[model samples]
Target: MRQLNKFTFNICPTVSIHNQINLLSNEDIKYTFNDFQKNKQIISCVDNFSEIERDECHIYFCPYESKEYHKITNNFPGGIFIHVHEIALFDEQPFEHKSFFQISQSFRFMKKLTLINDKRSRKLHDNNEHLSIIKYPHLSQLDLSEAQDDYIEQFLVDTKTCLPNSFYLCCRLSSTEKSDTTLCKKYNMNKLFKSAFVMFNCIFQGLSLFDRRFNQLRVLHVNSSWIRYSSRLTINNTENLPNLKCFSLYCDTDTVVYDELIVPLLHRMLDLEKLHLYLIIGYKNTFIDGNNLKRNIINHMPPLNIFTFNIRTTVHLHNLN
Candidate 1:
């Protein structure tokens, strides 16, 4: 197959000639060109290359340090999944020198990209143009953080295809809460995409998280520490998320958000099938309006297939009993 690069080469997930599809176990260990002398095994492992079966190689994984390796992987005829340290945007660095914007252009055939980064950066904001080139109908998953709303809005409106099926944002709650609300408020979630999965890990204030209707959203995941008081949390918009199937929420009681918020939010998700909550109970004494809350929730949302609840507690359950 090495000699068959002339034709479209496709590699399946099972083919192990080169462990290119699955990332190397030790790839997460930090290394540098200087450390190559002592880590020959690691160096040789990354240096090895083989002809990719273009048809089967829909997913590609690359290290954050290997700019040259990415140049080669980008040639694959299918989607590319590259490991990244973070969103790669550079001010003075040359475009050819490992910028996300440049890396994106390298794979014109790529339909989806799954970037793995431990942190978020403003570099994603700098790569707006390259991100727009994505063929929306083909792209399945996109995981990014600290991306600007202008770029996201443009993607929803300008694309010739539907938005991605699943989107993830991993970011610090404090940083985004102060800057993101205004930008996110300007866009209409219902009009953005027909059916989608959205996940966010960031702090939100006011109705930033609930004000907008998600008409086509099927799955939703949110991990935030603080909560604000807003009926938007309790208000249901069937026209926005008519088919919501699953919802997972993580919250702490030290904030204004509470079970009170959940009931109202539950009422809004008319078709919710599964519910997962991670609630942290603080020292504050509180009463459970369980009957009224559950009644409202059951009245609005769909029957559950499976329900899982995890509540952090310092007091005994018998106390509530």
Candidate 2:
């Protein structure tokens, strides 16, 4: 068997080349480039001019190391996954001294882009003048979970020209320390939600519920913190997300006041078929009527087939009907 015909390259550190090849043979493999130094052997083997083939390939890179993968992206044009940590890295020049935006522009055939950020990762700084200068027209799915508020804003501003069909944003609570709280206040969650809706209209179909524009969005996810500060921000209009089918929200803290934010948001997603919520109720003196809330949810979103909610110690799941 020809090597190019049988093997798929994976730039992950945890799995060996043999194991990756075996996994690739059994199922489609999504390569995550975490530590390139550790995978040098596999990289060298696949780097051979005869073995490398230009087929549909997916590449995932750590935000800071996207530069490292630029040299090899020519052979992979299917998609790119960027795990964003510090926004500054994207601004830095690497591999022939090209910025990430310039390097990304080389792959016009690329169709999907995934941006990921987690709580443990450092927050995105307020200054994003350097990032978000380019747009990928072929992307169909754009996921920006646990990203800094400024980063998302900059992305929306830059990519307003191109809208993906699926979009996701997950917000985690920052520490309540005075310094962090001050920074969080600068990036209000309410404004972020509002901007997301406005930008969604610019790229894809207009929001269906509002009859403002066509709705091409299908999947949406939001994970937020229940700190007292976020209580004021409500996802008041579900009509803005009429086409959404799968919706999930994980509330990090225990607070009933958050119900004010969640309930109204649920009411607006009338088209949702799947719903997941990690809620905190009755942790201390605060209390919420779970049964009544559930009934209200059912009444509003009649099309729901899968409903799951985790309320502190209790979990309720309603499977497909």
Candidate 3:
């Protein structure tokens, strides 16, 4: 009673990890798992355990409706089990890669993840190879947008998962460049995909608007009839987009998606800032000519600030009746 046996966790070091922790009828989670054995990264959750009743400093859990799985307890030292930060892996089955490497070792300081399994995972197409590569070293933010697509080839296919560095990904599939005609397998979908967040009717199939392997692409919104038939490529692979700023295209008629692939992909994005087009060009009419739209795309984007255009042109051949 003299301060309960001299316990001073610097004054309640935040201990609340329950959703299933009985610890033999829970005496305040067995005195908060024996003062967390002298601090273990202030564990918030998921240290991945389902068996630990040793009673002398081993209380890992899995109590609710327990079917038990992991047995963690070598007197503690598997990196004291990573402190779970934030993880969301909703399932209705199908989650292979050994349940994503046991949730990357029970959420090792996971940053922010949200996956809503759409069911696939046949060992991600059965070439298991002893499955390893699943690491989430302080992951940034990853929402699979209702995942499926084998979880986008199981985390951008860098042999299965190892993302970081500005890592922020939100997904919502589309063609996914299924034919491989210069999609280069979506540049293996990872080279930091510039913090990817694709899916505006996403269709960049048959590559066109520049790709020095996505040269750290910034942002591109496409759906202009599948990019007006491969948006006129071949000017040395459309020169330098140099980390394209931000762009959008939403054509429905296409006089070649605005004077030939949106003015040669906006003169190779000379560091474009932002521009959105809702073009419907077809009657040609030179894109409402204003000195050829200021010498072809407002003077080659001197760092365009923000310009939205709906300056349309259409005879609406209406997709040929």
Candidate 4:
């Protein structure tokens, strides 16, 4: 114990004590929590609630299907940082699930929030009265990937709230459950696309880019399959993406590289420094006029430092002189 404590200080005395505690094993969790309990130090729980810190620690409760989950959370000190995953279970008579508003108002110092895989039973209600009271100025990241559409809309309605630089809103929806139009209208999808500055590795399935603008976008990645299927479809307001630096497109078919789609799209990204195009041509004798396409792409785009075009059997790389 003496050697371990001495080694900890030697590594970094100012390192967050919570991070150091997280390195312990399950058996060590119990012993460490017990030690913290004895010393009355701030105890933070991530994944399990082996120790109760009352009102003096951050707590992250992963999906736990115990009726005692709510009781454990209720005992946490007000204004404490808490992250709850999925739905909080309850087994009492007239069983009801906890709402996001309820969870948000329960703590005063909510620093970071992440909700994942919330079933329909515990879906957040839009009409919750406590929506106005929920505020977290210190929130560094928010992930609502598995939350319901209504819940996400309600949370984002308060535009005054400062969103973190890294925000994730990608959710998996069944094809039959919701149509593209319904989902787009419910979440104001176009507004979100324009506002985000750096979008990394996102799938835009069922989204329409007609007349939409990307004002602050720096990096954009989209699969060609995400584009709506229409003979007359065109991406409007491409000029609005003035800050786009890195653009990538994954084409499942060769037909998406026409002037209406790929050519015009690349022409709009005047500030792009990196461009990657992945084309998966089927098992048939096919070839793209690479020399012609290369000359055109170089003429339209800025002086790029890295450019990669990968087809099924051919690879083209260009570093401009």
Winning candidate number (lDDT)? 3
Report the lDDT tens digits of candidate 4 across residue range 172-278: 33322225334444544444433222221223331234234344556665554432234332334345457768777765643433444456667777777888877
lDDT of 2 by residue, 53-161 (tens): 2222233322223422323422233233343212212111111212335535554544434433322223233344544546555543333443333444444433322
Error of 3 at 96 (Å): 13
lDDT of 1 by residue, 272-320 (tens): 7887877664423444345533665555655776667776545445655
State residue 162's C-alpha deviation in candidate 2, in Å: 4.2
Query: lDDT, candidate 4, residue 294?
Result: 74
Query: Considering TM-score, where higher is better, how would the candidates rank from best to worst?
Result: 4, 1, 2, 3
Which is the winner by lDDT between candidate 1 and candidate 3?
A: 3
For each candidate, how many residue pairs have backbone atoms clashing (under 3 Å)?
12, 4, 0, 3
- Report lDDT per candidate: 0.44, 0.41, 0.56, 0.43
Instruction: Give candidate 3 misplaced runs (Cα > 4 Å).
Output: 1-101, 106-135, 138-165, 168-170, 173-194, 202-296, 304-321
Q: Which candidate is the best by TM-score?
A: 4
Question: For residues 1-321, could you state the per-residue lDDT of candidate 3 as single tens digits?
Answer: 545633323111222345335533334545556655354433222233223212322333322122221322222223323545565664456667666677677657778778876667766666666768888888777877777766776677647678774566776664344333333444443265564555423454323535565567677555434444543334235667688688776646444445555677678788889988776567533336577667988799998989878766655444444
Lowest lDDT sum, 10 consecutive residues, model 2, at 200-209
Clash pairs of candidate 4? 55-77, 79-108, 79-109
TM-score for each predicted model, relative to the true structure: 0.51, 0.46, 0.28, 0.52
